[model samples]
Target: MMKLDPTNLHRIDEGPPSKLQRLIRRSRRRRPSTDATSRMAARLASAGVFAAEAPTSSGGPALLDGVRAGGATLRRLAFGVGGGALALVALGAAWSAWQERPADRMSDAVVAPTTADRTGPSALGTTAAVDSAAVPQPLSTIVPVVSVDELPSTRPGLVATSSTRTEVRSSSPPAPRRSESEFAIIKRAQDAVLSSPAQALDLAEQHARAFPTGELVQEREVVAVEALARLGRKAEAKSRANALLTRYPRTPYVVRLERALGEPLSPAPSTSGR
Candidate 1:
């Protein structure tokens, strides 16, 4: 080959070598030895381990501090929610208490009826007078005029005039005793109310003949009223109840009869009969 000019052989200001030439030169370079490669890998692994184990710049335990901060924040939130719920419940209870206050006050302020209420018939036609009349006549009559002097006296003085009067009255012939036949008839009438209402009617009619004006007669009439009603004699029952109410308006049984008849009777006694 001709002697190559230095300028041509050794280029000075040329751009980088072509891609193929650079690849060829790199392929010809010596590769590292196996031991040297392993040593280099160990050094790199040690550096990575040192970096992983390094302390934080903030001079604090980052994970533990973060966990403590989160726990404190959660506790505060829980406390706030619990307090709000408790406040709401307390407010609801307070509102309910406030709403009931007026009703409680009204109940406390209401007045109950006094003894004067016993003087007149109730809404259902009951009065102290009617209750008194239901007892046996002698006891009923004596209750209204009760006096301490009427009682058997322990003192020997003053002659016990009231006691003497009571004794004399007791010794006198008792008021005409009720006839046994009439009593038996009235009792039969009462008994017939459940078994034979028509027979009760017959017994009541017989009682009326014997003891026309007896108080027991009125009771028998009430029994007869019940029997008639049970027998589906509504018209007759109503009529008899009205007549009984008219005749003995002050009788204690009138209210019960009126209730059975499904009507309200006049509270005052009828003037025409009594």
Candidate 2:
């Protein structure tokens, strides 16, 4: 340090400020103004919290979207399952209705002819309907008969009478009419069993009367039993079934007759007190 000169005695000397003092001065100059920061300070002071809002992830919104998607999928699955069940129920009901329909066939009834027409030419030929174009001609009309007198002959040994009697004798018997086959008749009666029970019964009786020892006797019996069952004649059906079983024990129609009678084809037990 040096002493002041006599001429500079009235002047004074000073040094620069330190680093800490300069930092304090700069911070004080950079602080925000009171008017701009007053509102945020007042809000924080009233709530008694100085902490800021924390940062968060998008997990909550993502979870909500996932839940909504799951619910929609479940709803669609339930609707599809319900629709399928309803369709199956409707299909079952239709099948049941179709299965429960009546067994009688109108076509069979119309195709089979009555018993009275069995001897007719139309029935003997075929079971088909008559054609309009192929009509048969009618029989020739009958003519009046006239008697003529014959003169006497002059022969020696033969003597001719004046009153002559006309004797008309047919040389040959009338031609035998063509008839229907036994199998065809039996089939017709059998076909009518379900549609027309009364006609089937009559045809069966006619068959028995016409051909007692026919090859299709067992089949005829079956038709009769079926017709009786259809007509609600349980007693008659049972009697017929018993008779058929007694006649033909090993016949193929035995099963049908048994089913119709609702029992076995065996004979009834002896109920005469042992």
Report the number of the highest-TM-score candidate: 2
In candidate 2, what are the lDDT values of residues 1-274, reduced to their tens digit? 9786897563222235667667766766774422123222322221222211212244432212322332232223223332221111112112232233322112122222331134233212222211110122111211222233323356445332222112211222233434544544565675567679899899898888877876567767877987898899988897877777666665555556666667766644222112
Residue 46 lDDT in model 2? 17
Alpha-carbon lDDT of model 1: 0.45
Residue runs of model 2 more than 4 Å from their true location after superposition:
1-177, 267-274
**Model 1, range 54-171, lDDT digits (tens) per residue?**
4445655322232233223322322333222111111211223323454332221121012113323221112321222222234323323324555546744544355665765565
Give the range where candidate 1 is weakest over 10 consecutive residues by summed lDDT: 107-116
Residue pairs in collision within model 1: none
- Superposed by TM-score, candidate 1 places the C-alpha of residue 236 at a distance from the truth, in angstroms, of 1.3
